[model samples]
Target chain A: MKEHVHHLKDEEVNILLNDLLEQYGYDFTDYSFASVKRRLQRVYINDRFPSFAEFRYRVIRDSTYLTYLMEQITVNVTEMFRDPAFFQALRKQVLPVLATYPFIRIWHAGCSTGEEVYSMAILLQEMNLLHKSVIYATDINESVLEKARKGIFPLAYMQQYSQNYLQSGGQHDFSRYYAANYEYAKFSESLSEKIIFAAHNLVTDRSFNEFQLIICRNVLIYFNKDLQDKVLHLFSESLEQLGFLALGAKETLRFTTVAPLFKPLAQKEKIWRKIAT
Target chain B: MTVSLPRTLVIGGSAGSLDVLLQLLPSLDPACRLAIIIVLHRKSDNETLLSDLLATRSVLPVKEAEEKDLLRPGMVYVAPADYHLLIEPDGTLTLDYSEKVHYSRPSIDVTFSAAAEVFKERLACLLLSGANTDGADGLQMVQAMGGVTAVQDPGEAEVAFMPRHAMTVMQVDRVLKQKEMAEWVMSL
Candidate 1:
C-alpha cells in the first residue's frame, strides 16, 4: 500500500469548487470543506483521476463531467415521516401555536425531494391549516427542487412510509395522499397547491418572506460552524416574531448565537419558538 | 495472466467509532488485498476529520468514497455524513437519494445491503460498535449472498447492541476483538 499525502489541500479544493459554482451558478462554495472534499474525492475516484488537479481540469474542460458531478453532489437523500417522533411532537406541541394564526407562511428549508414538505402539508391539511397556509420549499439543488415540485417517489417505499405516517398520528389513509401507477407514486397536486418549490442557496440567497414556521431538518449538519451560523441567522431573519423553528432530532441551536434568540418548545425534538422582540 | 477479482469490505459503526477505527486501521496488514468502505454516523453539518485523521494512522490509502469512483485494492473509503453510498457492479461508487434506512442517510444497512447485491461473494461485511442495531439485517443479507460476515465481540465493542443483534440474527464467521479482527481480515 502506498501513502497518499494530503494531495487535495483545502484552499485548492475551495478554488476549484468555487470556480465550478461561479461558472455554473450552483453555489456550493459555502458548504463545509469536509463535504466539498468528500464529494470531490468521489468525483475524482469515479473518473479514475489520480489527483485533484486532473479532476479539476476535467471538470473545467468537460461540460458533461461537470453536469455528472453536479448530480452526484446535489442529490438529496430524504424519506417520508423521517424522524417520526419530531412529527409527533410537532402535532402535539407546535400545531396548537400554528392553529392560533388565521393565516400562516411556512418555509421548509433544504426540503430535498419534498418528503418533509409534503409531510408538513399533510399535517397542516389534517388540522384544517392547509387551506390557510402557504408553503415555500427551498433547496440549493435544482434537481431535487424539480423532484420536490413533481411530488413523486418510488412506490416500493410507500409501505414503510405508511407505517411511519400512522405512527406520527396521521388522520387519513396514507394511500389517500398519492396515486400509484406502476413503480411511481404521484402525490395529489392538491397537496402541493399551496407549495412553491424554488431553488434557493442558503449561502448566497436572502430570505424572501416572513414565515410563521421554519422547518429545516437534517440539512444544516452538512455545513461548517460558520456556515451554520450564517444559515441560522437567515432563518432568524426569515421568521416572524414569536414564530416557530424546527430542526432535525439530532440538530440543535444550543451552541450557536441563535440559541439565545429562540426558546425551546420541545428540547428533545429540537422545536423552538423565536423570542418576541 | 488473469487478474484476480478484488474483494470489498463494508463496515458500519456509530457513537464510538473514532477510537475503534484508530485502533483497527493501524493494525491492518499493508498487503491486504481488499478495499474497505466504512459508514460512521456523524453530524451532517460538521467537518469530518476522519479521512485526515485515519490517513495518518493507516498505510492503506484512505479516502472518502465519491460518486462513480471504481473500487481499488488496499483503499479505505468512508461515507460522507449525509449521503447514501452505494457500490455499482463495476466496483464504482454511486450516490443516491434512496430514502433513509434505520433513520439515517449514510446508513450502515443501506451501504451494506447495496454492496451485498452488487458484489456478492467478493464482499466482506463487518458490524462494529454502534448505538443501534442498524446493520444486523444487512450483514445477514451479505452472508446470505455468500459473502463473509464478521462481528466485533460485544464485550469488546464500544456500544454492544449492534454487534450483539448481528450475532443473534446471523451466524457470523468470526467474533473477534478489534485487533484480532483486523488480523483476521488481513489474513483472508
Candidate 2:
C-alpha cells in the first residue's frame, strides 16, 4: 500500500489534512497540494507507513507523528548567507535607510533553522547597528526553534559559510563570530542575544509588530497563490510605511494582489519598499 | 495498448545536457498540448542566461519557470537556476528553495519525483546527458508511477554518465538519439 502512495489523490490528501486539522489545531489545506504531497510521500516512505489512510490515522491518533509531519511540510533548507548577492544588496541598499530609524524592528518570518537570522545579526554587528536593532525570528516548528535558540551549527558547514560571508562584504574574519568546538560551531552569545526566536505560523498567526524591514526569503514559494497573497497582506500590514520587504531569488510580487502597494527597491534581489498610502 | 497522451513533458539533465537541449529544443511542436518542464544543473548566479539561450532555440516561448505560474500548453518552462520547480496538483508551477539533492539545487530528482506524483500516468519524462546519476532514480520513480520514460542513448550523449546510469538502473521506455528524441517529442 505504501508503494501506491505516489498515486494518492488530491481528495484523499484533503481528507487526511482536514482530519488532522479537526483533531489537531494545525492546518495545511491552504498549502499547494503538489508540494505538500511530495513532502508527505517522504514522510510516509521514510517512516514506513502502510498507506495514506494509515498515515492519516497515526496523524490523528498520535502527536509525535503529527509533529514529524509538520517538520517535513516546512522546507527548512537554509544556509548562512545562502545568497551572498542578496546580502550584499541588503547591506548597500536597505541598511542605510534602516540606519536613520532610532530603533529598528526586523521580522525574519519563516526563518528556518535560524541561519539567515544569525547572518543578519552578524551583518548588524559589523555595521554597528546591533544595539539599536531587534530581530524577531519565527517559524512554526518548535524543535527547529529550539535549535535556533541554541545558535549552534555543524562545524563542517563553517568553511563554506565563511566564504559566503566574505562575498557578502564581511568587514572582518567570519571565524570571529563563532567558537568552533568538536563537530559544531556555537555562535557568539552576543549575536544570539539580539535575536528572539519564537514559533510564529505564517498560515494562522497575525502580525505582531510593525517592522522596518521584513525578511521572509524562500518561505512564500511553498504556499499557494491564495496563501501567498494572504501572507503578503500580512506583511503589508505589519510593515511601516516605506519599510523594506525581501524575498527569495525566485520569489516575486508580480502575480500577487499586493504587487501594486510596493515598488521595487532592488528588483533582481527581490527587494521592495512599501508605498505610503 | 494505445499510449495515453501525456499532459506534461519533463526533461531532466545535468553537466552535458545543454548542448543536447540546444540541438533538440528547436524541433518541438509549437501546437503540442504538453507543458514542458526542464530541470538542469546550473549555477545560481547564471540567472536568465539559460532561458535566454534556450529561447533562441525554439518558438515555444521559453522562459524561466516563475513561482505560481500556471502551466500553459506549448510553453517551455525551464527550472530557474537555483530553485526546484514543482508541479502543483492544479497544474500550476511552483518553485521551491528546499535543500539540494545530490549536491545540486533545482535537482532533477526532486522535480521529477514531484511531477511524477502529480501527473502520474499522464506524465512523460526524458533523461538527457549529464555526468552524474541524478535523474536515474527520478526516472525510475516516474516509471514506477506508470508514466512514460525515455533516456538519451548513452552513445549519443556528450557525457553518458547520466543517461548511461539511467539505462543501467531503470527500464526506460525509449533510448533514442538526440534527433530521434526531438522527433518523438514533436510526435507527442
Q: Which one is best on TM-score?
A: 2
Instruction: Give the interface RMSD of each candidate.
Output: 12.1, 2.3
Query: Model 1 in CAPRI terms: which quality?
Result: incorrect
TM-score of chain B of 1: 0.93
**What is the alpha-carbon lDDT for the whole of candidate 2?**
0.86
DockQ metric, candidate 2: 0.62
Position B127, candidate 2: lDDT: 90
The true-versus-predicted C-alpha distance at residue A105 of model 2, in Å, is 0.9
Could you tell me the lDDT of residue B142 within candidate 1? 83
Q: How many residue pairs collide in each prediction?
A: 10, 0
Worst 10 residues of 2 chain B by lDDT: B1-10
Each model's RMSD to truth, in Å?
12.1, 2.8
The sequence of per-residue lDDT tens digits that candidate 1 reaches over residues B1-188 is 14344798988888776788888888888888898998888775334477778889987989877554678889999886677776644566665444466878688877887777667798888888878879987787787778988888889888888898988876889887876878777866
Candidate 2 segments exceeding 4 Å error: A1-9, B1-6
TM-score of each: 0.63, 0.94
- Misplaced by over 4 Å in model 1 are A1-12, A25-29, A47-54, A61-67, B1-188
| Best by the lDDT measure | 2
